[model samples]
Target: MAAPVYQAPPMPTDAEIARDVRREKRGRIGGRGALYLAATAFALFAALPFAWMLLTVFKQNSDLYDPNLNPFLYNDPPTLQNIGYLFAQTEYATFIRNTLLVAVLVVVITLLAAVPAAYSLTRLAGRWGESLGIAIFLVYLVPPTLLFIPLSRVVADLGLRNSVWSLVVVYPSFTIPFCTWLLMGFFKSIPWDIEEQAMIDGYSRIGAIWRTVLPISIPGLLTVVVFSFALTMHEFVYALAFVTSSAQKTVSIGVTTELIRGDVYFWQSLMAAAALVAIPIALLYNAFLDRFIAGFTMGAVKG
Candidate 1:
C-alpha cells in the first residue's frame, strides 16, 4: 500500500547539449567560409583586368604583342620605357591640365547649385516637391545620346562650343539632378529637432541648414564631388562632341585619338598613358569611397 516512488526523467548532460550547439555554430561558420570564398573569387575576377593593365604597361613592345608571354608574371626584363615614351612623346601634361580644370570646375559648380536646390525642395517645396524631384532625376536617367545633340545646339547658342567651359556647362545637366536627389535623402536622414532648435535660437533657415546640416553631410557632398569629377574626366562622348581642336581637346579625347598613328597601335604606351590617366581617379574613389557608398545608398533607399 506504499505510494509509488516518483522519479524525474534524466536531463541531457552539459556535454551533449554543448555538442549540439557546437554543431550549429560549425555549420554557420562553414556557410560564412563559403561566402568568403565566393567573395574572394569575385574580387579576383574584377581585379584581373587591372593586374593585366599594370603588367602590360611595364611590358616591352616585343613582349606586349606576344600572346605567348606569361600574363601573370613579368617578361624576363620588365621596363619603364613604355611609360617613359608616353610622357616624352605625347602632350600628356597639357591633356592632364585640361582634364583637371574641367573636373574641378564641374565639382565646384555641382555642389554650389545642387545643395541649395535640394535644401529648398526639402524645406520650402510644397506637396508636389517630392514628385518634382523624382521627375527631375528621371530626366537625367535619359540616355546621353538623346540629349547631347540638342545640347550641342544650345552650347553653340551660348558660344560655349569648342571651349573648355563647355564641359562646365554640360556636366551639370547630369550632376545637379543626382546631387539634389542625393542631398534630399541625406537631409531627410538628419533629425529635424536640431534644425528646429537652431531656428528657435534665432538662426535663419539658411543659417541652420549651413551650420547644423552641412557639417554633418560632408560625406554626401564628397559623393557628389566624386561623381562630378569622374563624369568630367571620363566622358568622351561629350568631350569629343564638343571639342575638335587639338589644342582644345581633353585628355580622354586626346589619348584615344592622338596617341596612336595608323594601325600601329602603341599598346604599351597607350596602356601606360591610360593607367596614368586612371590612377588619380582610382585614388579619388578609394579615398572617398565610404562616403560615396553611404550617400548613394541612402539616396536610393529614401528615393
Candidate 2:
C-alpha cells in the first residue's frame, strides 16, 4: 500500500480570530459599564440624604416651608442666621468643646488599653487567644442599655456623676472591648516570623512589637481612633444619664435636647449642627477609608 499522504489540522482564519477578539472586548466593556452604573447608583443613594441635609442648612425658613417651591432647590436666598443662632442662643460652643474633650480622652484611653490587650491576646496567649478574642467581641455585643444601669451606680459611687469625666470613664467600657477584638484580628494578620526575626536581632518582645508590628498597623490604629471618637461624640444614653447640665452635654444630646421644643423644630439650626458634626467625620472617613477597609478586611480574613 502506498504511504498515506501527510495531513495538517486546520487553523482558525484571521478574520474569525479578530471577530472573537472583538466579541470578548465588547463583553468586557459591557460588564464594566454595568458595574460603573451600579456603583454610581449606590453612591448617590448613600449621599442624597447628606445632600438634602446640606441644602436644608443653607435654606431660609421661607424656602424650607414653601410647598410650591422645589424641595431640593432654594427658592429664597440663603442666610447665616441659623448658624449664628446656634452659636448665640444655645450652649452649642460649650457642647462642642465638651464633646471634643470626651472624644479625645476616649480615643487615648481606648488605644492605650486595646493595643496591649490585643497584642497579648494575639501574640502571647498561644491557642486560647482566638477563642478569647471572639469572647471579647461578644462582650461588646452586650447592649449598652443592659449595662448602663449597673454602670450608673459605679459612676455615682466614683463621684463622677454630672461630670464630663464620667463620660471619659464610661465611654471606655464600650470602646475597649470592641477595639481590643478588632485589633486582635489585626495583630493576627501580622506575620509571627517578623517579630521572631526582630527578637533574634536583640529586640525584646515588647520592643519588637513597638518597632515591627506597630509601624505596619497604623491603619488598624487609625480605624480604632476614628471609631472610638465617633462613638464618644454620638453616645446619647450614657451622656444623658451621666450629664444633666448643658455645659457637659455632648453634641448628640445637646442638639436633640436644645434644638427642639414642644414639637417646634429649629429646622435650619438643627440641620446646620448635623452638617457640622457630620462633615468632619466624613472628611476623616474619606481620608482613612482605604486603609480602614484594608485593616478590617485583612484582619477578619486572617483571623
Candidate 3:
C-alpha cells in the first residue's frame, strides 16, 4: 500500500489543446474547399452549352462552318450578323410575341383553375382529397404524344387550329392538373390553425385564403407560374400539331421551321435565337430558384 505511489496522470497542455483545435479547423476548411471546388466544376459543366451558344452567336459563318477550326473560339472576326439576321430576316419577333402571349394566358388560366381546385381538395374534401389529388396528377403523366391526336381533333372542332389561341387553350389542360396537385401538396403543409385564426378574427374562408393563405404560398404560386410558362414556351408537339402558320408559331417551332430550309441549317441564327431566349429564362429561374426548389420539395409529398 505504501509502495502504491500517488502520481497525478498527465494532462494536455494549452498548446496541445490549441494544436488539436487548429487541426479540426483545418479539416473543416479542407472539406469546405473540396465542396466549393466540386460546385464550381459542376457549374462550369452546366454552363458549357450556354457558353458555346454565346460564342456561336457572335461567330461568322466561316468561323462556325469550318470543321477544322475550334468550335469554342473565333477564327474570323466576331460579328453581330447572326443576331441581325435573327431579328431582320425571320419572324423571330412575332414568334417571341406569340410565345409571350400564349405563356401569359396559360399562366393566368393555370392559376385561376388550379388555386381554387387545390384549395377545395386540401381544405374541404376530407380524406378523399389524397385520392383525388393523385388522380389529377395522373392526368398530367399522360404523355402529350398520346393526347395530341385527340387534342388536335378538339382544336379543329373549336376552330383554333393554325392559331396561337389553340396553344393558349390547350396548354392549360396539363398545367392545371399538375399545378392543382402541386398546390394541394403545398396547401396541406399549411397549418389549419392560421386559417382558423383568421376565420375567428372575422375573415371568411375565401377572405382568409386570399389574405393569409395566398400571401404565405407565394413560393407555390410562383412555382405554378414558372411551370405553366415554361411548359407553354417549350411545348412543340402540341404547337406543331395545332399550329402551322409561321406567324402563329412560338419560338420553339418558329425558329426551327423558318431557319432550317429543306437541307440548309442556319447554325449561327439558331444558336443566337436559343441564346437570347434561354439566357433570360435562365436568369428568371435563378432568381426564384430557392422558392422554386422549396415549392417542388414540398410538393413532391402526397397531400
Candidate 4:
C-alpha cells in the first residue's frame, strides 16, 4: 500500500490568474508592435529606392512613359528588356573591363607607395616626418578641377593621353597621399618594440619590416587597399579629364556618354547598373569591415 499522498497547491482564482496573463500579453504585444514599427520605417528609408529600381528595371518603355503606374508598386509583370538592351546595345563589357583593370592595379600602386611612406613616418616619429606626411595628404585636397589643366599637360608629357592606364598612373597622385596618411596613423599605433625586437634579433631592418611590422598591420594594409580601390573606382573628374577616347572610357564616363540620350534619362537601367557596381565594394567592406573599423578606431586613439 502507498505510505502517503502528496497534496498539490490549489490553482489561483480566475481574477488573479487573468490579471497575470494580461500583463504578459500586454508586454509581448508592446514589444512586437515596436519591432514592426522599426522594420517598417527602415524599409521605407533604405528599401524604397531598391524597390523603385526593381519596378523600373522590369517596366516596359510603355509603362515607363505612362504616368499611371505607381513607382512604389511592382505589380507589373517583370521583363528583362532594359537589362538586355544595356548589355546588347552598349560596350558595357568593355567598360567593366576597363574599370576593373584600373581599380585592381591602382590598389597595387597605392599599397607600394603608402606602405613605405607610412613606415618612414612611423619610424622617424619626428615632427618633420609627420609634417611631411600631412603635407602630402594636403596636396590631395587641391581641387581636381584646378589641377585638370596642369594634369592635361603632364598627361601629354608622359604620353599617356587618352589611355585607361593613364589613370593607373595619375590616380595614385590623389590616392597615395590620403592612403599614406591613413596608414601613417595606423602604423604609429603599433608598439615600436615589436619592430625593434625583430631587428635586435638576427633579422635585418627590411626582413623585420616584412616578417613582423607589415604582417601585424594587415588590418591597416587592407584599409589602404579598400580605400585606394574605391577612390579609383568612383573617380569621375580625373577619368573625364584624362580619358577622351571612347575605347578607353571607364564605366563612369561610359554610362553617361553612351546611355544618356539627351535629357531623357534611362533612369531605370542607369540606376540598376550603378546599384550593381556598389555590390563588390560592399562585399569587400562587409568581409573585412570589422578589421577596418578596428584599425581606424585604434589608429584614432593612438593619434
Candidate 5:
C-alpha cells in the first residue's frame, strides 16, 4: 500500500493576521472609550453636590429660596452677599482659624507618632511586625461612637474639654492607628538592603531612616498628613461632644451649630462655609493625588 500522503496545515496569511490584529485593536479601543465614559459619568455624579453647594454660595437669599427657579441653576446674577455674610456677621473667621490650628496640630502629632511607630513595627519587630501592624489596624476599625464617651471623660479628666486642644489630643487616637498602618505598609515596601548599605556606610538605623528612607517615602508622609488633616477638619461627633463654645469649634461643628437653628437654616451661608472649607482640602488632595494613590496602593499590596 502506498504511504499515506502527509499534508501540512495551511499557514495564516499576513493579511489574515493583520485583519485579526485590527479587530482586536478596535475592540480594545472601544472598551477603553466605554470605560472613559463611565468614569466621566461617575465623576460628574460625585461632583454634583459640591457644585450645588458652590452655586448656592453665589446665590442671593431670594434666589436661593425661590421655588420657581431651578435649584441647580441661578435665576439671577450671582452675588457675594453670602460670602460677605459668612466673614462679617459670624465668628466664622475664628472657626476657620481654630480648624486650621487643630488640623495642623493633628497632622504634626500623627506624623510624629505614626512614623516612628510604623518604622519600629515594620523594620525592628522582625516576624511580629506584620501581626502588630494588623493589630493596630484593628484598633482603627473600632467605631469612634463606641470610644467617644470614654474619650469625652478622658478629655474632661485631662482638662482638655471645650478646647481645640481637645480635638488635637483626641484626633490622634483615630488618625495614628490608620496612619501607622499606612506607613507600615509603605515601610515594608522599602528594600531592607538600602538601609543595610547605609548602616555599612556608618549610618545608624535612625540615621538611615532619616536620610535614606524618609527622602524616598515623601509620598507616604504626604498621604498621612493629608489624611490626618482631613480627619481633623471634618470630624463631628467628637468635636461636638468635646466642644460647645462656638469660638473653640472647628468648621464642621461651627457651621452646623451656628447656621442651623431648629427649623431655621442659613442655607446660603452654610453652603458657602462648606465650600470654603472644602477648597483647601480639595486643592491639597488634587496636588498630591498621584503620590497619595501610589503610596496607598503600593503599601496596601506589599504589606
Candidate 6:
C-alpha cells in the first residue's frame, strides 16, 4: 500500500470554469425564454375572442356578412353604427341598470348572510360544523331549472313578478350558500390564536371578529363579491322565468331577446353589447386576479 501512492488529478483552469459557468447561464436563459414564449402564446389565445369581438363591433355589416373576405381583418371603413344601434334601438341601458342594481344588492346580501354563517359554522358550531356546511353547499347544486316553477309562484305572491326586484330576491338564495361555504374555508385557514389574542386585549368576540378575522378575510369577501356579481349578471333561467318586461330584463336576457328576432339577428349590435359588458368585467377580474386566485386556492386546499 505504501508503495502504491499516486498523485491526484489537477483542478480545472480558470478558463474552463468560466466556460462552464457561461454554458449554465445560457441554458437558464434559454429555459426562461421558452417559458416566456409559452406564456405569451397563452395570453394571446385567451385574448383572441375579446379581440374578435372588438373588431366585429366596429365592422360594417357588408364586411361581416361577406363570405370571401377575411373575418379577422377590415375590408371596409369602421363605423359606430352597431354601437349606436345598440344604445338607440334597444333597452340596453335599462338592462345594464337593472343588472347593476341586482348585482350590487346580491353582493351586499350575500356578504351579510355568508360571513356570519361561515364564522359561526367554523368557530361556534362544535362538532356538527362540517356536516352543516356540506348540507348548505348541497343546496347550491340544485339546478335553477328545477326550482324556477316554484320560485315563480313565490315571486308572484310577493308581487315581484315581472320586476327586477324579483331577481334581487331570488339571487341571494343561491349566492349565500356557496359564499358561506367559500368563506368557511378562509376562516378555517386563519389561526384561532389571532382572535384569542385580540380578545385578551379587551376586545369582545364580535369586536375581535370585526378587527382581526374580517380584515384577514378580505380575499374571501372579494371572492364572494365577484361571484355574486358575476352570477347575477349571467343568470338567465330565473331571470327569464320571473321577469318578462323589457324594463326589468338583464343583459343575458335583453341582448338575446332584443337583438335576435324570430329569424333575423343583429350580429354587430349583439357583439357590441357583449363587448361593452364583458370588457369591464374582464378588466375587473384582471385587477383583482391575485386576490381571487388566493381566495380560491386557499379555500380549496383548506377545505
Candidate number of the best TM-score: 5
How many clashes does the backbone of model 3 have? 0
lDDT of candidate 6 over 1-303, digit per residue (tens): 469768898999999999999999999999999999999999999989889889999999899999999998999999999999999999999999999999999999999999999999999997899889989999999999999989999999999999999999999999999999999999998899999999999999999999999999999999999989888889999998988989999999999999999989998999999999998898888888999999989888886
Distance from true position, residue 4, model 5, in Å?
A: 18
Clashing pairs in 4: none
For each candidate in turn, the TM-score is 0.90, 0.91, 0.90, 0.82, 0.92, 0.89
Candidate numbers, best lDDT first, in rank order: 6, 3, 5, 2, 1, 4
Per-residue lDDT of candidate 3, residues 1-303 (tens digit): 468888897998999999999999999999999999999999999988888888888998887878999877788999999999999999999999999999999999999999999999999999998899889999999999999989989999999989999998899999999999999988888899999999999999999998888999999999999999888888889988888988899999999999999999998999999988888888999999999999998898645
Indicate which candidate wins on lDDT.
6
**lDDT, residue 53, candidate 2:** 85
What tens digits encode model 4's per-residue C-alpha lDDT throughout 57-125?
777777677678775555466678777777888777788889999998999988888899888886875
Tens digits of per-residue lDDT, candidate 5, 1-303, equal 999999998999999999999999999999999999999999999999998889888988788787988988888899989888888887899999999999998999999999999999988899998899889988999888889988988999999889989998999999999999999888887899999999999999889889888988899999999889988889999989999998899899998998898989999899999999898889999999999898789778876
Off by over 4 Å in 5: 1-22
For candidate 1, lDDT tens digit of each residue in 102-152? Answer: 888889999999898887787679777788788878878988777889999
Residue runs of model 6 more than 4 Å from their true location after superposition:
1-34
Model 6 residue 33 distance off true place after TM-score fit, in angstroms: 4.4
User: TM-score of model 6 relative to the true fold?
Assistant: 0.89
Off by over 4 Å in 1: 1-18
What is the Cα-based lDDT of residue 10 in candidate 5? Answer: 96
Residue pairs in collision within model 3: none
TM-score of 3: 0.90
For residue 71, give model 4's deviation from the true position in Å.
Answer: 1.2
Residue 114's lDDT within candidate 2 is 96
**Which parts of model 3 are misplaced by more than 4 Å?**
1-23
Q: What is the lDDT of residue 52 in candidate 4?
A: 69
> lDDT of model 3 at residue 221?
98
Instruction: Estimate the overall C-alpha local distance difference test score of candidate 1.
Output: 0.84
